[model samples]
Target: MAVGATPKIRLSLSEWGQMFIAFGALAWPMIKALFGNAPWRMFGSVEARRDYWRNVALVMIRTGGHWFSIRHLQFMMPNDRSACRLWGWMNWTSVISEQVDMTHGAGEDSAAKTERNPSIHWVGQSPQPVSTTGNNSQRSNVKVVLYIHGGGFVLPLSNGCITMMRTLLRETNDPSYGSPVYLALAEYTIAPYAEYPTQIRQCISILHRLSSRYGVDPSNLVLVGDSCGGSLCLSLLSQLLHPSPKLPQLPYTKGSSEPFAGVLLMSPWTSLATSAPSYTSNAGSDTLPPNVIRRFRDTYLPKSPDLSPTSTSGAYKRVDPMQVASLSGRYYDAVPDPPIKGLTDGAGATRHMDSFDAGNNKNDEWWKEIGSVAKRIMITTGEYECFRDDIVTFSNDLKHANDTSHGKASEIELLRDESFHAVLVSDFAFGIPPCTLAAKLSGWFLSVLRNPVV
Candidate 1:
């Protein structure tokens, strides 16, 4: 109901039971918020936090789209819109005023604005000025990380994103290299206010500005996103990999032709049309409820039924499920058509097919482009995440595309952890300092910078 629409499919009795359990589990958190300390705050150890999150995941599974839908969050839109407009006006004013105050030495005004304007803030630890050491060549090569926060395309930037960005900027700063990594946090428009593709265009525009106005070399640039922000990262990367007429183009990025140095995707929600094996298999362990994933997809994407030959009634007629199963261990071309009635029926079997058109046909070419460029691609997912299956399939397909295009092996580093969806971003809440994760990302960036990907 929060999504402004009813569930796409009817729930069975067991699903209703799970939903009830979910509601009951959430009651404790609701009460905690109203009376005592928040659950996340109360849990000081990783195990305690994990236990809390597991319960939270159960609630999410039950509540799914029922509470966080566009319809449910409509009341908060006016504030979100006003905040966005205010930030836009502030950004424009700052740019104009910065130029005007140059003659007057108006550093006071700039500092004051930075302190007061809080809607969407940029945390930049200005890269250190490269020393005149003989390593002057390294000074010109700067790594700018433009982070897009994810809240299922509904909620605005979260504290987790802020914390992560802050740590990222700090850890990435190599006082050794003049001008440490420049990091910018981009706040894009969300749904029920700005429709689909609007945020995508905004992100591209920002990237263009960063590359052109800020003088960030695309070769030294690395894009990182998590959760839905990860989804946007993928979408934007797809656009950059293959700029097509069908895809919206930003003027600044139009002529520039160079691939990013690397991309880091953390628990990215890759598909929006249908359910995956993990949707049901990991439902108990995953922090996101199965229906919640469905709800987010419905609220953000076009209202099209997942025609993934597996989701349709025609699968049995068109392809053989048995034949598809035989090819399960390896990548197969044909995706058997079907109504995919098994998952809902408690048949938690893995869907052997990967290339079923989940409405990503238009972006297939873009995926190929990513393969051809063969930029350092790192995808990490929770073993129990509902998105595990899709993410795995996408990574496999991407590797294939890269290998086929380059006539050589293109390896995509697929890392798995015994964690839940968005564990990296949500680590802080679960008593897990994100330093370990930040170190990994920083190390990855350093590796790329050390051996510039041609």
Candidate 2:
């Protein structure tokens, strides 16, 4: 089987036993919620408490996310087709998976062979042929949203992410938006199967294919990601602005320096450190557990010597740049040893840092170039989520960067809602009612599309 490939649907006896144990464990919480004695303090908002099923689902996710192995969860969750069928909107929307070449225009020999080829799921309208006219007239008003799903970089694409995309597609194409929108969900290789630059390389390949083959304009593409996926998006931006030593530089067809129209980050996991004030303050309110975050971090960026080039492990045989760079890259930050107290609490604390200041000493001038990647940028986070402090600090740094680079404070926008981590997508995934967050996100997208940067 290919690394990170979707496993066969058949479940082993152990998996079945685990499922049984999970159900048995959840019974008490189910009973409590049934009797109106549910732990409301644990939930992020009143809206989450209102839905019985959502409450139950949150408990299951919180428990399973912390306890269960990635393999077990992969089996329990439905495959892409099954997820679409469960939604019953499969008929209205078209979902097609295509294997994208990760070569980035390099010949076969130049590219490393891996079983985990990056694929994309075209959700609504697939790409149309570009006009041969001098102006490329037909694609002038078209916008493609490349969605990188959030699962801490380990879990598969969830049904909630699809629901969120469908809703965004419908909302963005409305008359109010005044533009035709298409969504392509990126399916990159997850962690443990692949690490660091591999996922970033896959994303670059997707972008390359979209522009080179489909003739989509780079300026017309919007990058959207949530959670760790948001981290990937930030990595992509960093790669574009300052090319990673390990990955190939993306070839922009138009030769225009600007690569994207807009970027939307939903509850981006900016820093992996669990010592942030929000991690302690919002522990009860947010659905994400700190242990789960640590597990995902370790799996994605393992410190074991086995991953060294001299090691014999075939899975991660080569010593990638991540092994050398560690977490002090442009986006991801290394966890502090002694741990910084309230590091992200104030703008002054974060303004001088390069990437989430976990005591890194990198020069902060590189951040000023962030405005060159996209015309407009919007980052949304939950006020009660564990990542709130980090996202806030990152946003502040990003705003300062853009202001310093472009002299426009309006170029960067931060939307902090009174909810938990990834509440909008999670709500849609659990079939919870649409909230103001969704509407606000839709408005932001519309505003971006309506106003072209050029």
Candidate 3:
């Protein structure tokens, strides 16, 4: 081989198949638009306005494409060992507390400041001095934001995630509430590299590290995630509330049984097993198409043997067989009946505990156990998002579980604003929903700290 020669690239059939999926995802929206022009372009509906601004904000972050676009193609297209080495830099990042440096915002100014000052001052895996550019002082409040960034479980945290965290920490300063926030960005292995529950276990590791090192109280820690990250957060919550024998045990659980302070989910991808009404009704309005959604689903939890015409099961079969199995049952099999009661939705509607006959009491006990964890759960979804219905279902299911267990329904506050899927995670130039949503999140975090339930 010559010193300055260009290397020839070859992709396996599987890689080619991935590329085909990527092309399909890219083309689906364009094809839909061609058939009957997007509603946002036609009628200027709230949904259209949201879709427009969010994409604009995304573009402002960087050209080429969104982080997911790059990740999607990279995962699908096969590369040789040499090519893998060349692209390995983009695939993953280290998760060690001392090594991970998350600068709050974007732009050359933040970059320059980070370069000059010790942005992340690590002291033996403990909470280091978190200093902003202007202040140069330490934050007094002992709050940590454990962020699980979203990109269909394939992409790493984008500029959007970094910027959102920076903005939230900067803007969310209330004189009344003296909570200082430090970010602990959770980095997990993406799929095609690792499968479903592996991401869950990685999250547990991050949680443990944050607790053991930073001395962050499990209750003071806020589990915040968007898209699939949101899904992971909820999944983790379910596991915590109701432990399963099949699943591995989580270490460093604060040496106590109390749950985290609060859980905030932004446009969580809850149900990948099937499509919701929003998948079709809001398909054109959403940035993510149905096929693209399924592609990610296929990568993480491929079609089960029963579902597929082919009898063989793929390596990634997390959701395949489990689709027919009751995950709730599995998790709650060993958990005792929950002690908490009076769970309800924001609407003040509650289910009657005795609505079902005594025969179903065993099932009700599991729901109760699941409901007892998490003092606060804030579910925010873009009204026109493809995930809207599933989120609604998730909320309702939790509410029902609370009702069945406690004999009264408790409120699960849901914010269904006019926006597209992943509005908060995406960078936006001018959008009412994203900004308002951020403010709401700040307020919620403050409330959680000031008036912690547990």
Query: TM-score winner among the candidates?
Result: 2
What residue pairs clash in candidate 3, if any at all? 343-409, 343-410, 344-409, 344-410, 344-411, 345-410, 345-411, 345-412
Model 1 segments beyond 4 Å from truth? 1-25, 29-121, 125-141, 250-256, 303-366, 371-374, 407-411, 435-439, 449-454
Best by lDDT: 2
Put down candidate 3 lDDT per residue, 1-454, tens digits, no spaces: 2110112234566546555554555464444443334435434765556655555543332221222233434443332222222332343422223322222212213222222111121111235444445523332337777777777765554545645655665544444555456666665656545554456656655555554445565556777889988878876665565443434344323226455677888887766633367877876567665545554554554233433424433322222211111222232222221111221111101111222222332323444654345667788898877788878877767666776764323336889888778877664324324567888877777677665653
How much lDDT does each candidate structure score? Answer: 0.51, 0.65, 0.52
The 10-residue segment of model 2 with minimum total lDDT is 322-331
For each candidate in turn, the TM-score is 0.63, 0.78, 0.61
Q: Give the CA lDDT, 0 to 100, for residue 200 in model 3.
A: 62
Encode model 1's per-residue lDDT on 1-454: one tens digit a residue: 0121111234456545544554565576556543353565335575555555544544433343333333333333333323334544543522111000011112123322221111123443433334344522222466777677666775565545555655555544667756666656665655534435545656655665554444566667777788777777776655555443433453224134456667778887676534567776887677665645544433454222553223445542222111111122121122332343333211111110111223333233335556433368888888878888878877776776675654323346887777778776666433354434557766776776554545
Candidate order by decreasing lDDT = 2, 3, 1
lDDT of 2 at 6: 43
After superposing candidate 2 on the true structure, give the runs of residues whose Cα lies further than 4 Å from its correct spot.
1-16, 38-54, 79-91, 104-112, 130-141, 175-179, 253-255, 302-363, 406-410
Q: Which structure is stronger by TM-score: 2 or 3?
A: 2
